[model samples]
Target: MQQLSWLPTHPDLSGAIGQAKRIEDPLQRLHEAVKLAAHQRDFTLTARLDKLAAAGIEQHAAAARLTPLRVALLSSHTVDHLLPAIRVAGLQRRLALSLHVAPYGMYRQALLADDPALNAFAPQLVVLALDAHDAPLQLPLQASQAEVDAAVAERVDELRLLWRRARERYAAQVVQQTLVPVAPPLFGSYEALVPASPRAVIERLNAAIRAAAREDGVLLLDLAWQAAAYGDGLAEPVRWHQAKQLVSPTLAPLYGEHLARIAAATAGLSRKCLVLDLDNTLWGGVIGDDGIDGIQLGQGSPS
Candidate 1:
């Protein structure tokens, strides 16, 4: 969506022109001058902000706060880069922060179970981190048309039995655990979040999820926006490369700022407790290979 228009121009047009002359790149100089004038609420300085916004250039300063609200952060990934921005934004909003890590599946299971402690926290929102590796399906299909036709004919004879069995199994599962409603549109659209999937099937599944959610009145927060903004598709190798580059000192701040914006967007939600895997996540070396003292955490040579 297009952002609002730029503010009014400043009284110091001559000074801005002088500064613009000093910049080497004519276009860049104009951009800088326009930005300076815009910040000063000068409309006559130019319509640069509107143009930049149209080009999808986000130039707002990092959000800052002195007294932040209480917020909880839940994620499986390291939050080193995200934390600073969140902290800055939270401070600006007067937010208090709490961080937690937990596996997505386990967290979902817990939420379904309606754990009192989880409910007691009464978070206004929750962020779920989903990875492509989580869902794997084994479908029944054949290469040849003859084989398919034969299989279909045989399955027709057993359709009644299959339906009964499927229904029974679904009912049993419902009795054992809560089933989150999943329907179409939103569910189908989410397939785009994956890198190597067939869009049609994903869309169908998404549609089903949306339908189910509508029927059950369950909220489904789509992270497609955030994923598209940060994810580098399903190529694991490429994602890893991008992640390394993102963590570099020069780039980390930009990532941090983006994270802060995300956190700010969901500021009211209380994050669940972080569940850590002790084996290799917390320490530099595996615990089995090295004693507790040998494991690198706070200091010493790299494990």
Candidate 2:
């Protein structure tokens, strides 16, 4: 685990407190002082500062308890815009922030797994950024904004109600973490190994693999469905047609992106060791008969 010194504070509260401290009114000064002390970096303060700050909030500042929080940020695009505000709040409240990039669907699956350590982080809030062009609808910007705002307001209200219900069921011991779904992956990979099919043996093997994956937790992204959608009667014969269809210029980039996503997801999980059948794969000539120099590695000989 990595450690960084910062705390999370409410931006609204922090700003209000800062403004309040500048006012001449005794009541306001006291309010602001309490706010400041509540969000202060260090616990140690002189009796004079504590008394002055505490009296304003109508409560003893020292008696206030602060909980350490962990926040995880999941997003596809750069979240640089929110970093400044998040950082300010973090510094004020002493929080730990972990940021990750992944497709929204994948993150949703991960959250549903329900790990206690994940819940303890307790991401209570989320900041989502979306581009209109990427998710275009028939409506114009003004209309879309109104629609989006209403949708978000409704979601917030629904979440509050859900939280209340969850608290009631679990009591104070239940820890709640927020899962915010963002835009889907712009690029992802789906793969299937179809044997020389219509050949009953090969088709059965393919079906079995698909079935097993479905039974397990793995998502079996059916390439056959994709082929049916994209290929114009071009994917029927798996050995010849599907292979040829894959090399088509229109499908190359899509295929490449899918393969890249799968590779990225499984990266660092295990080592891939390639064992070459050296007789045909590495050198052209038979190693038993040919001396090292006689072997057809780089030379023009068609061994």
Candidate 3:
């Protein structure tokens, strides 16, 4: 596999992971496994950790290491695949997460009607994620700027109402996901010039969402920014067509990691300190082993 460049390395990581799993004590096993999992970023490893953490929590062992956080995931599309990964990612930061996901297309119903189950779960953090397909304008290719503005604003206002309701009713922290730009370009480069194209309306809608979120003190998951790096592969057209999965299940681990961070932040568990290694981080290669000149740094060097 592919390596996640951002996370640092761990020597004999597989061996360490295997050893951690054999600890017998479910609580201790999960604690050790989470520490090892943080030293590397492998989806396979992430999946294993997810399983371990779930088992540990289910066993009802000593939970001193786990910080409890109840989360409400209100989304327009299917997000069941991302739950395990989100739980494990939260465990990496010592968070024990419990999720309340709105059923099917019933997210608005759950929030607006204040569904009894959601009210009982009492989420401390609420995430609102909508897919590109959920909100679309019925306007023409050459509609006026005013027409586009009004349509986009109406969608933003609807979301704003939901955010305010969640905060007021539950006193929960709210996070909004920027809709992924999965809609393909219709007019190629000329698409940007069209005032009322689907892409144009979505772009304007996302802009309005950012402004609304800021004004309402809503934290943003910024899925649009994350989707920009993965291109069409991130959304996976096949899964979207067959299962209505806005994000591919293959990317559940990565998606969960990001979502968990936002959830953790709401709980005041966001990383406050980062300690870096001098050898590989400050200068590429080992300075002591390779000597000073062999290290990559400064002009024409890679660090």
Candidate 4:
């Protein structure tokens, strides 16, 4: 397999950014600009780079042969800031992504055959991002377990239909996300045992998503797993509630990186082997002193 072209040995972020910005071709500009942004830790630069990358995708379309990835994003929330970062990260892994970010709140509409824009684009990869909070209805805690189950099932059925429609209308490889439930509800303990609570509904939806992914052979990105990893930092309440930003601006890179990793793996661009430091990683301690038996991390010992 061919190795990806990473950042040049020269560590000149500004110079590289300036050079990439000058390039006329958006995809080519993205190829260089994203790498520069990935190496920088500054949030300001990340935001700028994300915007730059997005502009690249928006200003021009890649020549079919030049782009290795033609990805159309169908998302519930505004992901204009997210798609560019994802494109650049994918480039790092050797996939030249040509990202078409569908308008926000088009997650359902894009899957339908009548949507001329989606039908016209017909991307090779379809990224379907949905949020449970965006659903039209929200049942209260007073609702019974049966009622909650029915509501959850209804949403699940809608999701499955969306996947099926996408499959039927296009040959694109589908990537869908498991919804991340918001923070603790105001009902608190009262909502804890209630199966119809917001949290419970989201959990049920996630389970259904997983099952559907298995049945439909769709690529599943676990946003719930990402949320757990980041703790409360996952969702920015102010931005989420006010602007409908599904993920916080501060943690957007993490989401971008996760998306890129999955896309790279799907595109056969990810690394094949993982070298582990056996002493600490593979085993609990050094084998020379622990003599294997003393070390934990075996079938008998606690992981």
- Considering every candidate listed, which one attains the maximal lDDT? 3
Error of 2 at 67 (Å): 4.3
TM-scores of the candidates in the order shown: 0.34, 0.22, 0.84, 0.74
Q: How would you encode candidate 3's per-residue C-alpha lDDT over 1-303 as one tens digit per residue?
A: 233446778887777777777788887877776786576555567767776666677555246456788899998888887787788778777788899998887778888995999999998998887888888778887789999999888888899899988988899999898988777889899887888877878888889999999999999989888776555446677888888888776677678878888877877888887788779877899888999889888654456
Prediction 2 TM-score vs. true = 0.22
- lDDT tens digits, residue span 55-127, model 1: 2112221221222322323333333444443343232233433433333345444344444554454443343
Query: How many Å off is the CA of 14 in candidate 4?
Result: 4.3
> Can you give the lDDT of residue 231 in candidate 4?
54
lDDT string for model 2 (63-110, tens) is: 333222323333322333333333322222322223332343233333
| By TM-score: ranked, best first | 3, 4, 1, 2
lDDT of 2: 0.34
Candidate 4: misplaced stretches above 4 Å?
1-43, 47-67, 187-190, 231-233, 274-303
After TM-score superposition, the amount by which residue 103's alpha carbon in candidate 4 deviates from its true location, in angstroms, is 2.6
What do the candidate models score in CA lDDT, each in turn? Answer: 0.36, 0.34, 0.80, 0.69
Question: How high is the lDDT of residue 190 in model 1?
Answer: 58
Clashing pairs in 3: none
Better of 2 and 3 by lDDT: 3
RMSD score of candidate 3 (Å): 6.0
